[model samples]
Target: MDKSAAQNSAAFLYPPIDPFDQRMLEVGDGHTIYVEQCGNPAGIPVVVLHGGPGGGCSPAMRRYFDPAQYRVILFDQRGCGRSRPHANVDANTTWHLIRDIELIRTTLDIPRWIVFGGSWGATLALAYAQTHPDRAAYLVLRGVFMGTQTELDWFYGGGAGRFFPDLWARFVELIPEAERTDLVTAYHNRLFSGDMLAENRHARRWCNWENALASIETRSPGGESPSDYARAFARLENHYFANGCFFEQDGFLQSNAHTLADVPGTIVQGRYDMICPPKTAWDLSMVWPRGTLTLVPQAGHALSEPGISAELVRVTNTLRSEAVALGL
Candidate 1:
């Protein structure tokens, strides 16, 4: 299909994710998580976990769930959009976020819901499933970020840095020259300093580099991302980093075999995706005995990529079909 035609497809827009679909639920320690519910109430549950440990939901998120087949639940992690304290760091910690996930699921009374997550969401799904295996029916994960030391090493410690020297340089440039070698530390120090201007600018630079890595070709469908997108993007990353991405091992490619060994999963990866790379998905397939790995040769990490979007819709359909096969 042509670009214009593909742009009109269901993946780009559906019932739509309402950024205003917000709810206030008080997590413990005076922290409240912002939750959003979409799709039909009686449909099979598909809980979505957005990236950024901090990127909140977008209307685009609604495209992942078939309105008639799956009930979608979305929420902003601590210190991110809509959630209270707006960049509040007091009780924001990895353990707190993990606990909050369980709390949200329990509150919704979701029994055996399918976990839909990408990037950091994938990591959270694994961790949540590990701690509560019986609660998770299965997982639909894309762009896995395991938070392993190696993955962190690659992103902050110079793996991704090697390719984006200029961005990396700017990240550390604001800090003292003597403290530049440990880029991640310098970045963390400044990013969490509560300097609004510095944090926002730094976040944009970090996101742009990742955005470039995400698409094999231009991923934007038509116009640029919404203006407030930068603020939303920055909020989540900063929250994730400050909170250790809600994991201790720095999660990517860590030993999750035992965690996901029995859980059925489908990993849809874009071969050309430079952001998370294809190996992450490949590695996941190796781990889950029941994982169905689909490689979109023409696509990359961008959800709107022509082939990738189509395949994801198909994956959702297939999962539903399989559920019928299993009499779920």
Candidate 2:
């Protein structure tokens, strides 16, 4: 409710720590991803995938796992954060990301790992696990999104628009009236227009719209984001969405849940998440074996939300004890 109270609420998170190791890994396609490792080098391996497909990993990501019990890995996906050739989407695709994850895993010499991700990160985690089920020992997902056309439409089409009409109008208003029918396409043009000023302006508006709805307590769109960060984030996210995240059809990820039958997963969702609604998470749990969904009643989509943070930290701690008994 208040600043001090809010701070106290999220105290479940480990205090922030600097990365014990950081490097720019060459993952081919002329792309070198940014990767970092924190916590104990010999701790139970946990790869932390960040959201946005572009929301690069942050120092706070390292706090989700207990430093003594989990070896946390964080990386900036291709074309984002500290990764090279910022915002360039030439070879970026869901499959490419899946391969990159494997490369990171093999390079680090981790036999297997617990996959932890949220939002778009959740989507990537699911894709990676389904592709390499044997490589993922456990999955801890938050604000689950399957990256289907319907999910994309719900957020960018008129679904989330109905709830946040004012913000929606501002978002759609940036494009020409003729182009309003397909907002993503319209924004894509400006985001990759190669005009720095145009890209920055549109990127800010795009990032602001999402940031505004990320938390239940947020009333106003956040202040302007850094131009470089916003541009890369907007471009890469738009690139993915514009291509339907390179899926065969809608609900591809959920349809492939059977592939994760041997993999146990914990899905943590925000009941009121405006972007990736609760229906997707509920649907996935019903179909996946040993999959459990925990919905936080008062939360939204942000990782920083107190309730969401608390639950994630609780999950990691619980898994730590389980890993010990299983000799992982």
Candidate 3:
């Protein structure tokens, strides 16, 4: 395994968490969130927002932040993991997730901390920081996808499918050709037909396709499913579709950045990232006045891609160094 793909040794030099470190917080909206923290509590605080809108915590997530230099917090967003709901999408929404992050921050008494998230997580991190700009010290975002219509279109249309012809064929094989051309129709038909079998199949397909994306960028191929991947991914898709991703139009490119200019941000982008094009990162950089963009050419969407993970560690280190310099 490449050292870069592993969490930084300097980051984890401090005693790591116990084998079992999961905890749940109740936010009183029938909402309970699963959370775990590692690293130095006195060091700068850093929160890891897992992608998938549904992707939960991982042991690897702990490596991105220096345990000696950061209070690394990783958690399941609502029903995703360890949380009580178990992928239930009934009362979830984007704004709900935003408040959840803030609620966690307050519950932990963290006045301000760095937010690190990728893909959908990156979108939420930006949205949350934008809404509560004062609460965030900085942001480290990757594989930036800002819940835009074009992005959605790309996912259901030719964007991902064009790259993997065989996978596209398999995906389309799930639906009839007429409906295959209509992405929205296919999702709707499969997601809401009271067909548990079909929905589960759709969820499985979605999960498998995404897993393939992850595998492509992984240094070694291995993963353990908690048996909740489909339910969580489906729930996230269900959550987004319910709110239209809280976008009136192009989310990232629009007036949504009304508060982004007030925040300092750093973006680590994989130049070859196909899942969420690095263009989204470029678009974000132009709006965030105090933003810096680093392009990692040898990367895909996976978290463990070549030097991407090492760079993530570096980002966390830089943030702590900067914050301490600021007397944080």
Candidate 4:
């Protein structure tokens, strides 16, 4: 699973599809989220959640589901993507996101739909499912992340740092030695510092550090992120991580696993995802009665990874067939 080879294999993904319906939905707190739908309007409804808590949705996400079989919905979470007040972290929290998801589901008139998400998106899907298990017909999760303190510490507390010392050192170098102990908070301060220049500078470093390690096969630091995308991404991510994802305690998702027992799910994880390790996915599968885990030995965390994409698309197609058989 050379990076290039993995990418080449992704040629099998569906061609980029345009949304037939798009709109900006107001979800209170002065936050308006960008929402779009593509594929058969009458097809089985499936909402796709992008990563980063700020990654937003991309055209590629539209390609995962069979356009003829799924009515795919994609949206930008609060303060991210094309949402208004770009980079605003005010009133943004995990709970707010869960509410937003509910608002979207209700707004679209969708009773129960398949939920597809990765990384932070997976975390949100889990929370949303736990909150409204009746609304989630099924789930397709990739790069599973539970938004737990332990998972955050593993990636930011020098566990991943130990493996990617070069990039980690650079990430830490941006902060003073004293503040390095809590990099998330240190970055949070700068991301919301109000000084545009300072925020962008720290934002690029924060984003670059994650991008550099996103794919294990290709370890080269990717190109510098655009100032706008970086600022929103870094600020939102830091805002969530710094507050421990706004949860009262760690392992919140696992504690609510029973809520999802009746919901079927597919957990597709990259064996060497540097950003989100496989342990969380493993733990989820063991407890989730109807969840099946598929470990892609040749992929990393990127959704574009060939092995990961192939499995996701395959699962979606499988779900479509099952739904059809059940007359869903």
Among the numbered candidates, top lDDT falls to 2
Which runs of model 3 end up more than 4 angstroms from their true locations?
A: 1-16, 19-21, 215-227, 252-254, 325-327
Q: Please give the distance, in angstroms, between residue 30's alpha carbon in candidate 2 and its true position after superposition.
A: 0.9
For every model shown, the clashing-pair count is 11, 0, 3, 0
**How does model 4 fare in lDDT?**
0.88
Compared with the true structure, the alpha-carbon lDDT of candidate 1 equals 0.68
| Per-residue lDDT of candidate 4, residues 134-229 (tens digit) | 888898999999998888888888999898898889889979999988778888888888899999999999999888887756776678999999
> What lDDT tens digits, residue by residue, belong to model 2 across residues 30-99?
9999999999999999999999978898888888899998899999999999999898898999999999
How many pairs of residues in model 4 come into backbone collision?
0
Which scores greater on TM-score, model 2 or model 3?
Answer: 2
lDDT of 2: 0.90
Deviation in Å, model 2, residue 154 alpha carbon: 1.0
Q: Quantify all predictions' global Cα lDDT against the true fold.
A: 0.68, 0.90, 0.72, 0.88
TM-score of each: 0.84, 0.97, 0.88, 0.96
Alpha-carbon deviation at 8 in model 3, angstroms: 12
Q: Largest TM-score belongs to which candidate?
A: 2
Instruction: Point out the worst 10-residue segment of candidate 2 by lDDT.
Output: 1-10
